[model samples]
Target: MTLPGITPYDGKTLPQSKAVSATNVHEARTALGNRLRELRQLAGQTGKQLAESLSWQPSKVSKIENGKQTPSAEDIKDWTRITNSTSQATALLASLRTLETQHAEWQRILKGGIRPRQNALAELDQKTRLFRVFEATVIPGLLQTSEYARARFAESIRVFKLANDINEAVEARLKRQDIFYRSDKRFHFVLTEAALRFRLCSPEVMLGQLDRLMSLSALPNVKLGIIGFETQYTASPWHGFWLYDDDKVLVETFSAGLNLAQPQEIALYATVFEELASVASYGRSARGIINRVIADLSPDDAEA
Candidate 1:
C-alpha cells in the first residue's frame, strides 16, 4: 500500500486545515449577533437607546451586534428582556453553548477532573455511527489497554495540576471501549509506526497494549491500518484527529480541543484520512509491522 510521487513526512509541522475552526466560530458569532440586532430593530429601539436602557456603553451594544465581542449570559438576558423578546433567551443561550463547545480550553474543561470529560465523550460515542480516526504519536483511545490508559491519564493529571482522579478516568475510558462491540457501528483507524513504537508506557504495559491492538483488529466492524516507517505517505500526518460520522472533526492541541463541524473542515479531514489509509498496511502486513515492534521491545524472547 504505497503511492509514488507523494512526499514522506519530514518530521516538521505540516500546514493544517484547522484554521477553518476559527473561521466557523467567527461565522457563528456573526449570525448570533445578527439575530440580536434583528430583535432590537423589531422592538423599535436604536443601539444607543438599548444601551442606555441597560446602562451599558453604546459601543458595547455595537460590538456585540457586530460580532466583535461575545456577550455574557447576563448580557444576553438583559438584552432580551430590554428588547421585549425574552422568549428568545433559551434559544440564544443554546447557540452560545454551541460556540463555547467549539474551542474548549483544556484547563477550563478539566477543572472538575477528567471523569466528566470522559462521560461527555461517551455520550457522543453513543450517537456516532462511523468513526474515522488517524493518529501520529500515540494509540487511539478506543484500542488502548487499561494499563496504557492509566499511564496516559496520569500524565494528564500531572501536566494540568489536576486532582488525582486517574483511577476513575481510566475506568471511564475503558468503558467507552464497549462501543467497539456494537455491530451497527463501524470504525476505521490509521496510525503511524510511531504510535506502535512510542514508549508512552512501560514495556510490559506496551506489550499488553500491542496485544490488544492485534485482537481488536480482527473484529468484523473494525479496520486497522498501520503506516510503517518504510512507507512513503501521500499526506503528512500533521496531527491526530477523530472524524465522527460526517458531522464533526475533533482535534486535540496542546492547550485546547477544537471541535470542527463545518462541512468543508469535515471533508478536508476525510480526504486526508483516505490518503493516509491508501499507503497503510492492513491485515497480515499490518500484523507484521506490529510484530516487529513487539520483537524490538523483547529481544531476549525474539532470540529464544
Candidate 2:
C-alpha cells in the first residue's frame, strides 16, 4: 500500500510513498541505509565500533547498511543514539512507517491479472517448507480442486469486475500443489466444519473437495484437521489465517489481505493456530466430519 509522505526530523520532506512500489522500495531503503551510514561516519565511529555498541553481529549491521534487511524502529533509535544525533530518529521513523505498511491492495494486485498473482504465490509456495492454515469460511486455495477453484475464481472475478483470467489463474494455482508431493515440505490445515458447507460450489464440487481433504490427510507430511461445531471453543474464528512457517502470517479479512511479519504478531497467530488445532479432529475423526457434511448433501453418497 502507498502511504502519504511524512516530513523527516530534519525538516526536508521525503516522498516515501513514492518509494512503495517493488522497484522503488529498494531505492528508498538504500537511501535510508546511506543516511544511517553517513550518520555513523559523522560520529567518527567505524562499522565495528557501532556493531559492538549495539551488541549486534557485524553481519546484522552490514545487512541493514547494505539494504539487504530492514531495520526496526528500535534499531534506528539505537543507531541515532550512538551517533549523538538523536534528532535523526524522527526522520528515520518517518521512512520506517512507510516501509512497514506494505499493504498490496487487491485491486492493484489483481489489476494486472489474477494469473500473475497465482505465479507469485507459486514462488512463495516453493520456498515455504511448512504451511500452517486455518479457514473458517471458504476452502483454502491449496486444498481446492480445479473445479472448485475455478468456481471460486469466477465468482471473485465477477464481484471485483476483473479480467477473464480464471482459466490461466486456475492452471497456475494447480501448479502450486506440486509442492504437495515433495517429501521435504509439511502442511497443517485446520478447517471449521462450516467451510465444507459454505455453498461456494455445487454439491458435487463440494463433495469432491471433501474427498480431496480425506486423501490429503493421509499423506505423511500433511496434517489435516476439522473443527466440528460440537467442539467447544473459547476463541471466535474472526478471520482466516495462513502461517508460512514462523516467519509470516497471511490474514484474509473482508476488505484486504493482511501480511503480518513482526515477531509479536507472528507469535500471537501461532498461539491462535495452536489453540484452534487443539479442538480439531484429525485422521478418521476428521474424515467423519467431512463425510457427514457430504451425507447431509446427498444421503446416498458415502464415498468420502
- TM-scores of all models? 0.75, 0.67
Q: Which prediction has the highest TM-score against the true structure?
A: 1
Backbone N/Cα/C clashes per model? 0, 1
Question: Any runs in candidate 1 off by more than 4 Å, and if so which?
Answer: 1-22, 26-95, 299-304
Candidate 1 collision pairs: none
Q: Could you give candidate 1's per-residue lDDT for residues 179-283 as a string of tens digits?
A: 999999999999999999989999999999999999999999999999999998767788899999999999898888989987766776787888899899999
lDDT of 2 by residue, 1-304 (tens): 3233422322232223222123345556687888999999999998899999999998888888888887989999999999999998998999977765544457756897789988987887888999999999988999889999999899879877899989999998888887889999999999999998889889988888888888888889999998998999745576688899888777654444556676655665676678789889998899899989988888454554
Most accurate candidate by lDDT: 1
lDDT agreement with native, every candidate: 0.88, 0.80
